[model samples]
Target: MRVTLPLLALGALLLSTGCSGAEEDAAPPPATPAQDGPAEHVFAPGEQITADLTMYDGDDGRRTPFFSGYRPTIEFRHGGLSGECGVRLPVELREFPPGETHTVVLECGTEVVVPADDRGFALVEDGVERGTGEVVLTGEG
Candidate 1:
């Protein structure tokens, strides 16, 4: 009887600690911004643009530099109006002066020309204009 009681207690303890492992995991509850994850930042257009330029190939999820030793600025433009987007790891590596300009050819056979700054720029894919964009450099900046 004593052993049975101990085993029962152990089982209860395990269950309380979520050790049953029988149910599929559910989506986590929403957490505070500083609690478990970063606070989401919605991209706003004409939002005093100041950031790095990057290239993202949504087709194959390849975010690589156009050339092995090249680091072109990350800017964009597609078939429609301009907008903003968030960047992740594997960004442009080459550094440039804040007000300089450079051109780079993406591995996807795209030719891009734009400012080396994080502001407005043009993205030409292998000489062909893109169909979409995260945030395009618009106007005559």
Candidate 2:
């Protein structure tokens, strides 16, 4: 199956929980080392992104076009530590035969970060969780 995931910076995990609040923009706090290194993660705000996805059908040697029409939905959630945050982009695909490959490109309009004390976002399809990814803040907040 064709699955595309976000390209996040090193040492950061993004998560989403169905919570909403003011779309506040703030400067990202200094990077905290998850392990001993230059910096564990970097968080910025108000950035743009473009991603290309390739989907392949496993059952058959044909590529599935289901993801081409998938709608991209965005959401945000809090992080475990204070000031940390995460964003989730959930793309919905039309039903297909069992074990069909589907791929598409997800264009994240803006780059945001996972708030502290919360996990990163999760990708859900038809109410079933498919994958997990991280979100980094970019640009001016």
lDDT of 1 by residue, 33-108 (tens): 6443222222333233333343444453234343333322334432222222222323473542223333322222
Off by over 4 Å in 1: 21-46, 51-141
Ten-residue segment with the worst summed lDDT in candidate 2?
Answer: 80-89
lDDT (tens digit, per residue) of candidate 2 on 9-121? 21123224423353547778999756332222333443332222222244332233333334424333443222122222235654433343233223344444444334255
Estimate candidate 1's alpha-carbon lDDT, on a 0 to 1 scale: 0.38
RMSD of 1: 15.4
- Give the candidate number with the greatest lDDT: 1
TM-score, structure 1 vs. true: 0.23
